[model samples]
Target: MSSPPPLPERVSAVATLDDPVRRSLYELVSQSPVPLGRDAAASTLGLSRSTTAFHLDRLAEVGLLAVEFRRLSGKTGPGAGRPAKLYSRADGEICISVPARQYDLAGELMAAAISESGQSGEPVLDTLARVAAHAGRAIGAASADLSSALTANGFEPRAEDDGGIVLGNCPFHRLAETHTAVVCSLNYQLLCGIADGAGDAAHTIVADPDAGECCVRAVPVPQIPQ
Candidate 1:
C-alpha cells in the first residue's frame, strides 16, 4: 500500500533509567494525559514537593521525561520565590499497562496468522506472500501508532542502523520485572506482524521469544494459553 511511511530505516527503544526516585517520576509522567508539574505529581504520589522535584529532574537527566516551563503561580508575581517546576511523563512516555487489551490482543495476531496459513495451496509462496503481506500491513500500522502510544506509556522508539530496532528507554523495566512473559509476548506479536511469513520462500515464523532484540522478527508466542 503506497509504500508506507518510508519504513523508518530503523527504530529504537528508550534509554535505560535506573533509580527509584527517577523511576517513580517516570511512573507519574506516564499517568496523566497532559504534562504535570512536580508539585501536582508530588500531591498525587504523596511525596514532598522538593522530593518530587528532585526525582523529576533526575528522570529528565536520563531522557525519560518531557519537561516544559510554566508559570506555576501568576498571582505571586516575580516578587515571590523561584517559580515552581513542572513534571510529567514526556509526551510519548511508555507505561506498564494492566492488561490494557482485553482477552490478549496478541491472540488476534496468531489467529490471523493461523487462519491465513491453515489452507491448501499448490505453491506455498503465494500463500506465504499473502500471509506475510497481511501481517506486515497490520504491523506497519501498529508500529506507526505504537511509536506515539508507547511514548505516552513511558518509552521512546529510536532508530538503529542495525537491521532492526532497539529501546533507547524503558521506564517500566522495574514495574514489569514480574511479567516478562506477557511483555515478551507483546514484543513477539509486534514481530509477527513484522516478519510474518519470512524465510527463503519456504515461509517460516520465528519461534524464539527474545529474538526481536535482533532484526529478524523471530519472537514466538505460545499457542495462546488455551
Candidate 2:
C-alpha cells in the first residue's frame, strides 16, 4: 500500500501512538480519571521504567499527553523526595481536515445557537447573532489582519470604492447558492466572525448580493443605519 501523505499537527500528535508500547501507555493514561505516574504505567504495561519514561516524554512533546508533577507520598519538603511525573490526556481540540472545510464548525455553531434559543426562549436569529459574534471574537483574537485572514479562508476580499471591502469569492459558494436563506445567514455570521476576529469592529457585513459575486459585503459601520 502507498504511504499516506503527511498528517497535520493535531493528527501527527495522535499518530505518535502507533508504537505498541506508546499506544498501550496512552490508553492506560487516558482511561484513568487521575493522571498516571511513570512507575504505575511501567508496572501496568510490564515495561522497564526507562522505556516507559522515554515514550511518555515523547507523547508529551507531541502534545498528546499533558504532564504534571506531584508527590504520590503526599509529603512535602526535602524528605518527600522529588515529585513524580504524571501523565494525562491533553486538553483542547484536535481536528484535521484535508481540504480545510469548516462544515463541522458551522454545524457546531448552528447547533449551539439553536439549543441556546430553545432553552432561553429567545429568537433563533438572536441566538445565532450572539453565537456568530462570539465566533467572530475568537477569530479576531487569533489575528489582527482581517484581509489576510479572509484571504486565507478563501473569501477573496477586494477593496471597495467607498473605503469598504467586497468579497470576490464565497468560501461557501455552493451552499449559499442552494440554501440561500439558511446558508446566507450562516455566511453573514462567518463574515461577522472574520471581522470580529480581525478586531475590525468598524466594519460589518451587509447582504448586498450582486451577479456572480459573494452575497455579503463589508461596509463601514457608520453606513449601516441603527
lDDT, candidate 2, equals: 0.76
Encode model 1's per-residue lDDT on 13-50: one tens digit a residue: 13334556666667767777877887778888789988
Which lDDT tens digits does candidate 2 get at residues 144-203? Answer: 577876665556788876768887777566666677787678778767877876778767
Best-matching candidate per lDDT: 2
Write down the TM-score for model 2: 0.68
TM-score of each: 0.32, 0.68
Q: TM-score of predicted model 1?
A: 0.32
- Which candidate leads the pack in TM-score? 2
Candidate 1: segments with Cα more than 4 A from true spot: 1-20, 75-81, 92-226
